[model samples]
Target: MWELFLTGVDAVMSVQIMILIVLGVAVGIVFGAVPGLTAVMAIALCLPLTYALGPAAGLSLLVALFVGATSGALISAILLKIPGTPSSVATTFDGGPMMEKGEGVKALGAGVVFSFLGTIASIIALMTIAPLLAKVALRFGPHEYFAIAVFSLTLIATLSTGSMVKGLFAGTLGFAFATVGIAPVDAIRRFTFDEPNLNSGFDMLVVLIGIFAISEVIKVAESVRSGKNAAIGSVSMKSIKGFGFSMKEFFGQIPNATRSALIGIGIGILPGIGAGTSNIVSYIVAKKRSKYPEKFGTGVLDGVVASETANNAGIGGAMIPLLTLGIPGDAVTAILLGGFMIHGIQPGPMLFISQGALVYTIFVALIVSAVLMLLLEFYGLRIFIKLLAVPKHILLPIILVLCVVGAFGLSSRVFDVWTILLFGLIGYGFVKGGIPPAPFIIGFILGPMAETNLRRGLMLSDGNFVGFLTNPISGAFLLLAVLSVAWHVVGSLRARKNASTELAQA
Candidate 1:
């Protein structure tokens, strides 16, 4: 253990690697501070570049990017009404209102502090539990994996913030997209359209850019004439320092942070729900548990802390399944798993025992990334907040061009360019219809995992309807999905009844 720690420490101590880690954090903060851009897209853009570096450096870059991007999201959520990522959705509840109330610095400080703590807690949890979890996960065969995947997708669709029908449609579209080019089972070409470039389906990064970055461009263009989408406030050093809630008030919110972190981590370890949905869930949980629940949605720090802490901690929660079982728990980890492949490391129980040193290095890397994110975000606020000052007219076009370049660079194919535009339009349609994009992205990312597993599980059981229930692992996941759906339904009904009562009194 001491030897592994020293080796990992040595790797981090290299000047070049430290520079790279810091660079990744800077880039991630910028990406994350922008609405409609996310950690998945940032990591994807950086992946091609990482292909040239050593395992430690490459992993450091990607992990730093992930940590920075995830943490960076609170910036936009606070300053702008929209969250930079789904994970920041809860942050927006308090953050946007607080910014409106001219308390941007307070919201930002609380968010950053809690986000750091949440991340640290998650890493500690990972250090302790990932190995044991992986050993149990290794017992899962293809059938169980497929079942688990199916359960995850179903839970996502049911839990997503819109009509179940639309969620299902999105999942179907994603599953259909996954089926294109070639069959995963037999290398059978299915929907290649004979264009020769479609044989690999969609590169994850290309899809990410399309669904996120390009979609934002399209939305921005649609609003170009109206000019109603102006940013609400700017982040300044003054804003950062003035974010004072009493230390006592912050201490009082400790339960909110801890509970939200646990919830975020719990939801994260579960497949399909994704960070976006987790934030929404955490926000609701915090509001419900707060002594002054009425303060929720009224520019309170508790809301910001709840959302930021959970979503950030989620990075750790999601890694549990990915590192231990080789099954990606979410989109970012799915991409991180790609990094593991490039290093010729297979994840599972064997990964824990065989690559103990590397595993610890990766764990240590998460801690390093968090520290770097903290330092850069605090000291470098002036540099990043300046981005919001860029006129939308100039910034929009540049981002559009970057989106185009990013999409094309995914596989160096024109088809992906078309794919980006197509998804951009689809995403625009959703926005126009008030369908939240978070669930759609979650559904799309989880589609393949869900589809493949369900098919495999059913085939393994000879089409027995009871198969999911017969397997303990599959049964547990399916059960959770059922309970989640039921709980949401009950909650919604109660909310509607309360609203009706308030209207009657008015």
Candidate 2:
């Protein structure tokens, strides 16, 4: 083990490898900070470029990009109240408010520092516990997967944060969207309307651009028309020296950061659920556990810590399942699976045995990438703040153009562009209806997984529905899902009761 570790260290220590890692991190930050672009797109674009490099160098670049992109999302989330990636959605909750309060430097600093810590923590866990975690993940069958998906969907209760009915409606709408293409099991088309483009269904990228980027543009347009553009606020380009926080505050956030990182790692190890879910889940958990839960959405550092930490940690956690089990945890890692196969590297137990040094080298590269991401983002902080100075009227139109370009870039289909515009309008309607888009996005991402797995589980059990309960893992997850919904109901009832009592007294 020691010899292989040393060999791995030597491989990544080369000047060329170091340069690639830095370059990749820089490029990834740019992509992630820009609305409508994401780490998945960055990795996809760089895929062909990897063909010209050595396997170690190519993979290292991708790893660096992954680290940088995840961390880079905080830039837009804080400065513009727009999440650069879905994973940064929770970050926008508190981060945007912090920026409005002229604490942009502090928010960005905390996000960057915690992101580094979270990535490092997850990498350490991946290095030490990957094989064991992979073994555990192997036990998950179709029934278990379906149950997990159900439980994940129930998290919409936590994300709703406003109206449960609206949340459920939005989530159900997402599920309906997911079913537009061919049926998973029967391969029968459902809602194609004779359009060849609908055969493949709506691209996730198109949906994301439409919901986030295009809708944001529409909202900005409305604000401009109403002459309330001042609500968007301005960024304070405050000079921050170190991390822009007192040592006491840093110590205070340690527990939240640790818990969030662990959640990220656990979720990352699970297939299907990615940092996008982890960030929100972690933020919810942190808020529920905090002494001042009421301050969560009001620009608290705790919220930023939980969000940034978990999403970045998820990168390492995601790598664990990908490398050890050959299962991609999320979309970016799915692309990475192709990167591995392209280099003739098949990830699994045997791959580890066959290429111990190479695997270790990749691990080392991940750690290096985390450190590089921190340094790069820290130095580039001022530049990102400068971007906030761009007027909303000008900036939003640019973002709208980027959204169109990004949607069109997906498969180069005009149909996807139309999809973006359609979803943009739908998202705008959702906003007007006071429905949170987070639950909808989550439902859209997880709906197909749940449907496919449920069908597969039933088929495996020979149409015996009881088998889902008979399986211990599946039963446990299903029970948890039910309890989650029940808990939400109980909380809602208690709140309403309290409100009624207060009204009567008044």
Candidate 3:
């Protein structure tokens, strides 16, 4: 094993592989910094370029891009208050506020540093316990998946910033939208309304662009129309040195960052759920565990730490299943599986035996890419901040154009563009009505998973509902889901009671 590892390290040290890693990371950062673009798009566009290279070099480039793209999202999330990718949605909750508070540099620094730590931590896990983790993931069945989805759905309560009722409503609305496509098992079309576009449902990317990006553009336009300052905000680099944070502060967040990394790894190992879900889940857990939960969305370093750490850590986590079981952990890995296949390499239990040196090459490449990502972002922090200096009128139009391009680029359909416009209006309405969009996104992503698995679990159990309870893993999650709702209800009741008592005393 030591010999193979050393050989892999040597292979990655070559100039050709090193140059590809740098180029891939640079391109990935650009894609992720753009609001409408994403890592998936970056990988897809550059995948063809890899066909001309060797297996080790090609996979190395893809791995580097994955690392860079996941970390780069924090840039736009902090600077523009728009998530550069779905993985960064939770980032905007605090990152935007931090930018407004003139803590942009600090937020970016925390994001960058923790991203490196998170990736390193996961890579260690990938190197040591990948096979063990993959075996554990194999234990999951439809029942367990359904229970997990239920538990995740209940977490929307934690995201309810202003009103729980509004949050629940938004989540339900998102689920309803998700139901627009064909029903999972029955293969029956319910909400197509005789339109072909609605048959496949709205793309998640399009929805994100519409809700966050387009709604933001609309909000800015409204602010300008109302004679308010149209400029988003400004950040300063003066007198700020070394990540704009203290060692004490970094030490303070060690526990939070560690816990968030674990959450990211656990979630990333699951098929379908990737960094997109883990980042938000990690943020919610961080807020819940914080000494002062109220301080979370108020421009704190903890928020950025939790988000960036989990999402990037997911890079290594996602690879575990892909390498050990030949299963794709998420969309990016699904594409990566294709990259593996194209190179005549199959990833599975025998992969380590069949291609020991190549496997280690990927591991080594991941580490190099992580280091490059840290260095690049460290130096590029100011350049990201400079984006804020661009005039809103000019910047927003460019963003809108990119959003359209990204939407149309999905399936080369104009309907997706229209979908963005429609959802943008809905999102604008959400903003006007004091509803948080995060819960809606969560619901949209998980609702279908829960529903499909529920149906499958029932079928497997011969139409017996008791099967869900019989499975210990599923039962435990379901119980926790119930407890989560009850806990929130109890907390809300107590707060109201206290308010009433104070009023009576007054």
Candidate 4:
């Protein structure tokens, strides 16, 4: 195993492989830091480019994109008071405050460092644990898969920042959208709107880009309308020193970071929840356990660390299911499915046995990509911070063009372009109505998989609904989902009661 790892490391260090890793990280960071562009969009648009590269090269491209994109989210989260990715939304909890306080460089530095460490830690864990985990995942049948999906869907409350009703609606819409296309089991089609495109349902990436990116453009336009072009805060290494590693601070946060990473990896390795939801899970736990919870949104490094680390850890965690079981843990991994297929490789058990070397190579590449992320963010911090000055009017127009290009670029067809525009309007409406967008993307991405598995599970049990609870793993997940909802409902009630009590006392 040691020799194989060394071999993989040697292979990753080759000039071509190294160049691809750097190039992919650079591209992903740029895409991820920008509101309208995303890591999935970057990889999806670049899938064609990978066709000419070797297996290791292609894996390097995708993994580097994943690593860089997850971390790059913090750039916009800090500088723009907008999350570059859903995963970075939590960063805005404190990151925006830091940026507003002119400590933007320190926040960026803290985020970049922790994000790199998270990636490195998760990559090491993935390399060590995937083979063992694969053996266990092999035991999952359709019912278990259904259970996992349920467990993942329960995260909607966790993902929703302000309102549960809106989050549920977004999540439900996603599940409903998944019901589009031909049914996975009986091949029956539902909700196609009789349009051929609807037959395949909405592409989650399109939905993600539309919801986060397109809605952002509309929001930016409004900000510009208000004549709000907050001066770009200057970022520098000198200003970043305050956030440097400290033993006391490090010990205090070790548990939070570790637990958050574990949470992120677990959610990320799940089939549907993905990093978008995973980061928030980490942040909530970190904040809940924080010695100074009230200090979380107050421009603190701990908040930045908790979020940035978990999201990066999620990248490595999401890869486990994709590489081991051919099950994509998220939309980004789903696109990676295409990348692997383009290289004539299958992603199941055989992937490990037949392509062990390549898997190891990808793992090595992720570690290298993590290092590159740190280096780039540390030195190029000013470039992203400067985005704050481009004037909202100019940036919004560029965003509009980029959205069109990104969507159309997926298929080189105008149909996808229109899809982006339509969804963009939907996203804008969702935001305007105070709806949370995270669950919608989650639902869209998991829709087909959930639908297919639901049908398969039914068929396996001759359409017996009770079969869902007959299996231990499936039963456990179902119980957890129910308990999760119950917990949230109770917590909401208590918080309301407490607020009322305080109001009465006052």
TM-score, each model? 0.82, 0.69, 0.65, 0.78
Q: Residue 251 of candidate 1: its Cα lDDT?
A: 88
Cα deviation at 483, candidate 3, in Å, is 0.8
Residue 383 in candidate 1, Cα distance off native in Å: 1.7
Please give the ranking of all candidate structures by TM-score, highest first, separated by commas: 1, 4, 2, 3
- What is the overall TM-score of model 2 with all chains considered together? 0.69
| Candidate whose TM-score is highest | 1
Record all residue pairs in model 3 with backbone atoms less than 3 Å apart, i.e. clashing.
none
C-alpha positional error of residue 79 in candidate 4 after TM-score superposition, expressed in Å = 6.6
Question: Alpha-carbon error at 319 in model 1, in Å?
Answer: 2.4
So what's the TM-score on candidate 3?
A: 0.65
Looking at model 4, residue 84 earns an lDDT score of 82
Clashing pairs in 2: none
- Candidate 1 residue lDDT tens string, 107-214: 887888888888898888887789788778768865566666566666656656677667656656666676777775567888887867878676655665666667
For model 1, the superposed segments whose C-alpha errors exceed 4 Å read: 1-6, 80-82, 92-104, 228-250, 274-288, 291-300, 326-331, 334-350, 353-355, 403-411, 429-469, 475-506
Candidate 4 on 1-506: residue-level lDDT in tens? 67778878999999998998888887788778876567876775566567568888888888888888888888888887788888898999989998888777767877887888888878877887888876787788889878776666666544455577677778788788778777775777788877887776666556666666677677666656767444444555663454454567667667877887888888777655667777777888888888888988888877888888888888888888777767665657766775786688878656777888887888889899999989976687676556434555766676577667756655577877777777778888887898866667666655566667788999999989899998999999889888877887888899999999999999
Regions of candidate 4 where Cα sits further than 4 Å from its true position: 1-11, 31-56, 73-111, 157-159, 197-199, 235-311, 321-358, 385-388, 395-402, 409-412, 503-506
Candidate 2 global CA lDDT score:
0.80
Clashing pairs in 1: 105-239, 105-243, 106-243, 146-453
Give the number of the best model, judged by lDDT.
Answer: 3
Between 3 and 4, whose lDDT is larger?
Answer: 3
Q: Report the C-alpha lDDT of model 3 over 1-506, residue by residue, as the tens digit.
A: 68988999999999999999998887788768766566765675566567679999999999988998898888888887888788888888898898888888889888989999999999998998765654565667889878877776665544356677787788788778889889999989878989988888877667766777678778878755454322344567678888889999999999999999998888887654678888999999999999999999999889999999999889988898788766555557755775786688977666876888999999999999999998888787666555434555676677677778767776778998999899889989999999977667666766777789899999999999999998999999899878877887898899999999999999
